[model samples]
Target: MAAAQGIYTWDSRSSSYSEIYARVRSWWELLPDGSNPLFVLVREFEATGVTAGSFAVLAEQFSRRSGTAQAVRCDLELAKVQEYPAPWDGLHVCTVTVQVVDESNNSRNAYAAPVTVMINCPPAVTAPTGRCAMVGFYATAERIVY
Candidate 1:
């Protein structure tokens, strides 16, 4: 028989919505072209607390602490994307993009993704007030130019 196909609707009274979603995922996995993209629907309120940019920053920090020495070095350069030619004759060369978000959550976009955030920590009793921000970064290893 040719591949059979049918559509069925279930009443919520009979099965929980979670079960329906699980079934859909199982069917998706059986598709012939697994490469097809899967789009999921989630309520805005249902999303996790952090935004995508914040999540990228968190992952970058984790990688910095755990990744290879080159990874750490790359971040250092990324911190200053405008700078050129690998400080101290480094082995890898890279380009960086930075973004800035203001106190009111307004964002300043640059030609590339941001690598650092400027945040102000509490000052000493005699010191002045401060502000805070976040930036994103990514770098690819490049061959030595010289």
Candidate 2:
């Protein structure tokens, strides 16, 4: 069996953080047997006016045409937090990783249709109302096919 992979990038402006979606390629196949997995990695995350501990990353596999979520939702974990200078002063930069559950038992036709990885930012109780920015944001979806 060989593995098929798709790499998708976030194409919107950094200021738009409400609902960030990465479009997966239509040519990639989604295999059965629970082998298809999507990985989201954010190399640089910044929430202006929000503290490091005041925000969470929520990600889900969704189908826009159907207007339904296809896979289990996950909370991305921040690997590290660091302080920056000048323009980013008082803001914390973080690294995040999200792995969506395997896409299994779904119809091949359903999988063939357009799918997206949607990312959202929800503020914690102590967090102030602010905008979220993601840099180097991308997703990788892989499946093994015979």
Strongest candidate by lDDT:
1
**Candidate 1 local accuracy as lDDT?**
0.25
Using all chains and alpha carbons, the TM-scores for the candidates as numbered come to 0.20, 0.20
How does model 1 score by TM-score?
0.20
lDDT of 1 by residue, 1-146 (tens): 00001002222333344553344334332223332234421121012122334435433333111111111223244544335532222123232222212121233222222111111123322112452111111121231111
lDDT of 1 at 114: 18
lDDT scores in order: 0.25, 0.23
State residue 20's C-alpha deviation in candidate 1, in Å: 0.7
Q: List the candidate 1 regions with Cα displacement exceeding 4 Å.
A: 1-7, 30-34, 40-146
TM-score result, candidate 2: 0.20
lDDT of 2 by residue, 31-139 (tens): 2332233322322122111112322221122211122232322222222221222122322222222222222133222222112222222352222346422212222
Please list all clashing residue pairs in model 2, or write none if there are none.
none
